[model samples]
Target chain A: LDATAVADAEARQAGLVKPAGALGVLESLSIQLAGIARTCPPAVPGAPAVAVFAGDHGVLAQGVTPWPKDITAVMVEVFRNGGAAINVLSRACGASVTVVDIAVDGDVAEGVGTGAEVLSRKVRRGTADLAKGAAMTRDEALAGLAVGIEIANRLVDGGADLLLTGDMGIGNTTPSAALIAAFTGTDADLVTGRGTGIDDETLNRKTEIVAAAVARTAGVDDAINLLAEVGGLEHAGIAGLVLGGAARGVPVLLDGVIAGSAALVAQRLAPASIDYCIAGHRSVESGHIVALQQLGLRPLVDLDLRLGEGTGAALSVPLVQAAARVLNEMATLESVMAGPDA
Target chain B: LDATAVADAEARQAGLVKPAGALGVLESLSIQLAGIARTCPPAVPGAPAVAVFAGDHGVLAQGVTPWPKDITAVMVEVFRNGGAAINVLSRACGASVTVVDIAVDGDVAEGVGTGAEVLSRKVRRGTADLAKGAAMTRDEALAGLAVGIEIANRLVDGGADLLLTGDMGIGNTTPSAALIAAFTGTDADLVTGRGTGIDDETLNRKTEIVAAAVARTAGVDDAINLLAEVGGLEHAGIAGLVLGGAARGVPVLLDGVIAGSAALVAQRLAPASIDYCIAGHRSVESGHIVALQQLGLRPLVDLDLRLGEGTGAALSVPLVQAAARVLNEMATLESVMAGPDA
Candidate 1:
């Protein structure tokens, strides 16, 4: 991001028709966008694309959530068929959806479906149970990250100015909680929550699982090793998307806990990658708050959304556009004073 | 609102692919839309229109804000010329802007400008200084409300499913703080804030002015009389928009402190009016919080927005549409199970 452009945008926001600081976060957001674009007023982000990284969580065997592990593959199909929440929300926000099969347990064909594009980029079918052992080898985690980075590069090269991270992995929040707790050094109990409406017994067990996983990875400061030890493949992929988007200077809108945990990984890999990231919404998942706090990202929307198929991030597309539009389309106070139509 | 439809929408929400209640406020918002439309799945709110009621406050003579009194008229022109924050945001959200000159002290023509439609509905040049006397006569307040109701009806009749409340009145927050303090029984210091921008001395004086005005209307239970005593014409007009949108079963998205205070008046006039009101954003103004609390409304966006030209409301159009689209477009879990493309 260009500091000169940021300064220019701040000056521009000051002179806009509204009172100084009246637009609040939006004023700062526009400046950030400008800085990212290396311009006085950032161009309105065009062709937003949400990449839903689908994988299967090995931790589901521990009963972290009641949902079946097969539900993950079913959701990838659901996403590809335009039958999911992210599809509906992306349509509403005029964004495209791309479903990437990173490591789902079930078979998913690679091609553009009737709804969203489906990419077969699976590094593995599934990971080893994180509660018992490493979720994946470091190489597998790096492979997942490479897939995400490739997808993000493809989307950006194909004219996507904004990238949104979406994830579909059953019981993935278990690993998300573990990842957030490990990264933030927060108590596992505080970072874990009921995923997909789990019972109290399951939630407690999930907390224990998260605590044990974080404790196992306590001395591992390497982001990839930590991700491989406890994070799901989708988390690795989503982190790669964040890093890829940041490398390309495209803003990545992060969804719920899955994306938040992934963002923490991305931030550890490259501290400045957090600069190009936007927290789309505060998820109901408790760990999401910790992850966002650690990343220093304030969500653009807070609808108590816990759904992680990028629906929350898709909903914020218009807001991100409006932030840039205000900078580009709105007349300065001096211009307004010059003439009504100025 | 239809109770049966609300129940049906809730059931439908549960059947969606995502976890139950994962969508959070969006789930309730969709159910509310269903109730408003009297259907299980409400049609996506289409053709959102913002009615920016422009007025002048006699309380500008009270040294409440640093902006010139003529800023009200200048902003109205800015809105009409599509150079205002509201216009830029509305355009981004696929909404239309309509500037209504309900009580501008300066002359404003009635016609469709190159940007927004300017409606000539001025009831009077301006209001009397609320610090000294009634802001308007009872009949004038009623007339201002009539203008608002008429505009809402016209927009809804023209196929607008959503009506957004906007206001352009220099020093309007002085009266807004007074109105909120009156209705919510909050302290003047608690409700009062820097409208555009004010120093310590002006803020203290503004708080005193609000305290004095609310004291004058301490026992006034009549909503209309209360509006006449302390509310600006734009407030009355915006209240009318709320009432009219409610009466017609169209959702009304409300902007900053001015719209918040107006919605309070609308609620007092007809408590049911709040059922159709959606707080667009929590304004930076302290009084907006008090007013939203009194109305029992949760804001969709809280970007610290205080520029009330329907900019905040307009920014929520995509979110509102997404809420409804999820209900209408998302395939039920059972349907997804029926087939991959179901």
Candidate 2:
């Protein structure tokens, strides 16, 4: 981020027709965008792309979630068919969707279907049960990250100015909670939540599994190793998307708990990457709140969204565009006061 | 709202591929829209139009806000010129802007400027200083409301499915605060806020003025009488917008404190009108919070917006549209569960 551009944006916001701080978070968001774009008035972001990373969670073997693991592959197909929640929301907000098969347990075809782009970049079929051992090898985690970065690059190079993270993995919240607890040093019970609506007994069991997974990875301080130990393949891919989007000076709107956990890894890998990330919405998932707190990001929207196929993030695209548009298109106080001649 | 449609929407939500309550507020919002539209899956709102009601407050004489009364007229011009915050935001959200001069201290021409439609329907030049006496007669307040209804009808008939409220009046927040306090029975000190960023001293004085005005209107139990006693013309007009929009079964997205105060008037006049109103964003104004509480409305966006030119409401158009789209477009759980044939 360019500090001078941020200062310049601040000065410009002060001169806008509205009262100082009248636009609230939008004022600061515009300034942050200005810094990211290295321009006083950042371009109104168009061509937003949501990258939905599909993978399967090994933690499902522990009875963490009631949903079938095959649902991940099914959802990838649904997303490609433009019939999923993320697809509907992205289309409503005028953003394109790309489904990346980072590590789905089942096969997903690589091609464009309907209005979506499907990428075949599977790092592995699935991970081992993280409750008993590491979720994935360090090499596999790196490969997941590579896939994310590659997808991000492909989207941005293909004319995407804004990137959003989406994920599809049954029982993914278990690993998400474990990763959040591992990095933020929060208790598993506090960070764990029911994924896809689990019962009380299942939630309790999920918490125990999360606590054990965090304890197993307690010694790992490095982000990649921590991700490999307790995180799912989709989490690694999302982290890479964040890092890649930040590297390209494009903002990444993070979805729910899955994306939040990925962001923790992204932040750990490169602290400045956090600056380029926006908490799209606060999810109902407990770990998402902790992850947002650790990232020092305030969500633009809070609709209690827990279905993380980038629906929440996609819903916020207009707001992000509005923030930048206000900076670029609104008349300044001086201009308005100076009359039509000015 | 149609109860059967609402029930049907609820059933449809349950059958959606996502878990129950996963979409959170959006799910409820969709059901509300369904009820409002009297359809299980409401049509996605295609065209949203923001009616920016500009007026002047004689309460400006009391020094409640630092901005000159003339700035109201200037802002109306700015709105018409497509250079104000509201204009930029509305354009970003693909909503049209119509500037309605319900009351202004100065003359405003009635004509289209740039991309905006300007309507000159001034009931009066301005309200009387509320701290000194009643703001207007009951007739003027009714006329203000008539103008709002007429504009709402024109817009909706012209193809706007969503109506949004916008206000531009110097020193208007003082009357808004008084009106909120009068209707909600909240103390002035609790409801009054620094309009357009007032200093500590000015805010204190403003609070005192609001208290006095609320006291003056203590005996006015009727909505129109209460509005005439302490509300601005823009508030009355906005109340009408809410009423007219609701009568037409179109959703009205309300701006900040001023719109909230106006919605209180609308709700008083027609309790069912509140059903059609969506709190766009919670304002930083203390009065808006109380107004929202009294109205039993939760804001879709809470970016601390206080500009009150429909910027907040305009920004939420995409969310509202997405809410409806999700219900209409997303594949049902049965369809996904039944495999490709379904």
Candidate 3:
């Protein structure tokens, strides 16, 4: 069952009364589901879960962003304390967000207690400084993938039909771009953007560094090899989660450039993994467009958003739900005895 | 005791949080309440009643819009039936919207099946074609204002602490621009803008017509006189609602261009009415900016929005609540005892 067939069957469901094309993109989404499930009226009982992957990059030591590196921990504290933007948006969207300390150096228990669930799977207290050394070893990359798969399986077993992947890593975009360039066969210039609003001089330097990193591992074919050479642990984890969603047939909403690049790596690992992926929105990051186009994904909203705390995805969740509701709820023209012109 | 003091107290309370300026514009809003209520702790109770006034203008018969005049009634049906954008946004914001049919030449009871409580006080089937005659007589304008005040009083009695004024009148922007020009001493050409996506040629004609109407009513002292000469009944009603909110110390969120012009009229009627008014967002209309500036009211959101179904105000409702919540909920620096740098 391909994407087109999935869309068609979802639209042809008896309970959905509107004409097949009435709701535009929403109708197409309904049909896409039918083709995927190989059943009319694809059930989308949403058990929404957001995975907030927290990590640190050694690259932060090089003064890429103006904010202190500790602000990341402070923000993680804020997230834990339910004061962050993601917490507000998640609350508005009615999704429970779990903060996963994938590579933040301390015990998750030591931090300000997040009101939500906390998952601690620290992979070596963060990646090696990507500028000087590989971010992680191939073995560590595989471990990250295993962790992501485990999380996804847990969410599904807990009755989550939809997964939202978010990341909170200072200076992770450099590694994210490197991974995107490696996977998409695009050069660093096209796949690198100003992360955290760097100056022109720093942007040029960052682009050159990512290009050098991508060039070092041009022949890497395996997902584990790619992850070991140029991926943050959180990136690897999210990629694995995307693949996990595909295996379980649950929809995954990707947040920001980091999650987008991770999805690209996941698609390379499992080509059919694209079926479960939905681009939430294009971030202000220049690389996000390149990665989204590579994956053939279209965003639901575009508000010149650059904030990466999954706020854009959370705002877009309503639109996605609206699309599904329109497919399932709108009265058909035939039922209303109204002509298309009416 | 007064609106400005209330706004000021709210702002001071908001500023005393753990981080003095963390919430951005929301901080200013808390202060706005201090000024409005003339007190230290401004009351922000949730008595959210949205008044969606529906009407039609005889000017619409001039084919100024590509959409038919009947769309005015159909869209009222859409709003009543919960299919319009306002319905979606109001539902998201948890505000109940009441549809008031004012001077629209249609069966007022036809679309009342939707859950919206319909208030029909027809000033007339519609306003006179502004191109050839005054929109309404002085008696009719006063009658509209009375109807609006009556509705506001009823809403207040029913426990509404906030009034949201929205309009659904087709081709009413001409009258709105004329009213603004009459009140603001601005030339109609500068204040008039393309309404409902009109073409450049139609816009020019609309602008000329509005300028003439403004010229005809230059020396009006009372807002009711100006409204009678140039405003639609819905416009007069909204103006009266703004005054009612001010007199009763409830805040009113003004929607789009027509609502902005109405607020301007309300300001002229009661200069202190500015205390009760909060510009929801700057609509794409050129006159709205002038009206907002003249009234010294700053808008919360600026999305270049022109969809005038109270969607902008509804979107800002959460922001307003957030502003009030920050004032009321966030821990103070003394309480948290954290670094003042926070």
Candidate 4:
């Protein structure tokens, strides 16, 4: 019924063990689930699906990464070809990866019959450069969020008990940092990091640009307005996924900085939205740690992982599953005839 | 066929659409097969099993962890009752955990019915303190190695394609660090880390103790002598699992410092043993980095994780699966007709 309820349910399932508190944090998570679902033995099923939203940023034209903007489409091809990191990881996790062509430069045929299903929901070819104007209009931001919600709902209806959120958009971190700074009221410098391995000069420039974007949207208090001001379509989509996951009572694994920014925005939209969110890993990015701490969620993994292709979330899937498994399977001390005194 | 050939064939069958070289290291792995029997579409079945080897050290009488030596048996009961981190994580990975009561104060019932199967292969109920004399006899070391190999071979025969190596012996890290320092030719101070959150004073004492053990084992060149000089039976078993994995063609995921130390011993016995090993994570332990680098294996995750219950390897399982899956599932550019030119 509530977040605390879901957490309690998760703990009860975990506590039915032969040794009390033996499963550690895993048992704690079972309680977390109980609080959120307001039931014991929260029925988490198989058939989890991961939605990876890909887009392009007008800021990329400013030379954020060494690779060209066209590499985005090439990587879309890579994902379709099952050669990308996320593709390989998803297959290992036994979770299907669905790619959303939210803002590719050109019109790609819908459902071109790739390795995984491809969702063509282009809000625009690319976002407008935040340096020149708002990244997207309010209408566009809302549309992207709707697209994410639609995709998440479809996957759930199709029997995906879990939803993992990943993003594949270059230069999107600039907008992500800007949005995080706006929502958390942190200084842009503290929140932004050298994304995609930028040079010192570019890193400094990126930080300044993000700060300016945050300043521009200083008057906007609502998360949706902040998103419309500086957020990429992928960010909006991720925020929508978080909301959708909370609505469906499915845990959403947030990948990296981009996803963290989106989660912050989603929390602002719905205070209870944090219930469904699980921080996958603490990215090397400065903003990510701040964002995660602010959301009061600890990352399962903390590799100097800068890759934002849902790789972190994929790696953490087993850990989360372990948490659930301990809740469901471990035997209690009474059943084993092991006394508490013993 | 040899291990390399087997690994290569398995990689090829996983089926990446490109020329295979495009994925670099992952392609090479798909080619090698990691000891799986069949190369054609190397089917890595899901019934994962983790062997947690528990032992007691005479050094516990010298005071290492704040917990007493009796707690080792208590924890074993915790493991049996499914209250440990391994239980939670293993369940999360859909893996069955088996606890090997290799060393303890008293006789554990043969095939003691815990939620997990307990294999009592105790070597004199624990090793003598290395500070006093050799930790274990050379004959005992060999027998332990044999037991590890036997179990690994049996698991493979029983349809387990992947083997996760975990250890659970109190004050075992002291022996593990000593063994690592002896083999890696590193100073004990560099290799010995504050295991299990010891105080700074305890850490210094641990360093000195490990250094002394390394000094005693300096002349020993072979695994048998090394094990006799300063190795835990659990460590010896893990080394055998690494070699057995290569010999049997099942991938062995190394957990933490203990497993890393065991790997070093295995390499001494057979240099080609590195073929079947995958470093699961770069744990918080300082020795882990040295061992991983010496082995020339990159960890899939780097979470500063020091929990040595196969939690690191369990987390990396999805990534390993992903690497193989990308080879198998991703559509080739030719199939998609997307054109090789971006």
Best by DockQ: 1
- Candidates, DockQ: 0.90, 0.89, 0.09, 0.23
Error of 1 at B25 (Å): 1.0
Q: Please write out the lDDT profile of model 2 over residues A1-342, one tens digit for every residue.
A: 999999999999999888899999999999999999998899989899999999987878899988988888888888988888998989887899999999899888899999589999999987779999999999999999998999889999999999999998888998999999999999999999987798999999999999998998867899999999999999999999999999999999998899999999999999999999988998988888999999999999999888999888998888888899888988888988877765
Give the alpha-carbon lDDT of every model. Answer: 0.90, 0.91, 0.73, 0.75
Q: Give the C-alpha miss distance for residue B169 in model 4, angstroms.
A: 3.1
Query: What is the per-residue lDDT of model 3 for residues B58-122, given as tens digits with 9 covering 90 to 100?
Result: 88766666656666776666666665556655665667878888888788773454536777878
lDDT of 1 by residue, B1-342 (tens): 899999999999999988899899999999999999999899998899999999998988888888888988888777877888888888887788899998899999888875799999999998999999899999999999999999999999988999999888888999899999998999999999987789999999999998998999977999999999999999989999999999999999998899999999999889988999889998889989889988999999999887788888988888898899989999898987788444
TM-score of 4: 0.79
Query: What is residue B291's positional error in candidate 1, in angstroms?
Result: 1.5
How many steric clashes does model 3 contain? Answer: 34
Please tell me how candidate 4 rates in CAPRI terms. acceptable
- lDDT ranking from best candidate downward: 2, 1, 4, 3
Candidate 2 lDDT over residue span B73-108, tens digit each: 888888888888888888887899998988888989
Q: Against the true structure, what is model 1's DockQ?
A: 0.90
Question: Which regions in candidate 1 have their CA more than 4 angstroms from the true location?
Answer: A340-342, B340-342
lDDT of 2 at A33: 93
Model 1 chain B TM at 0.98
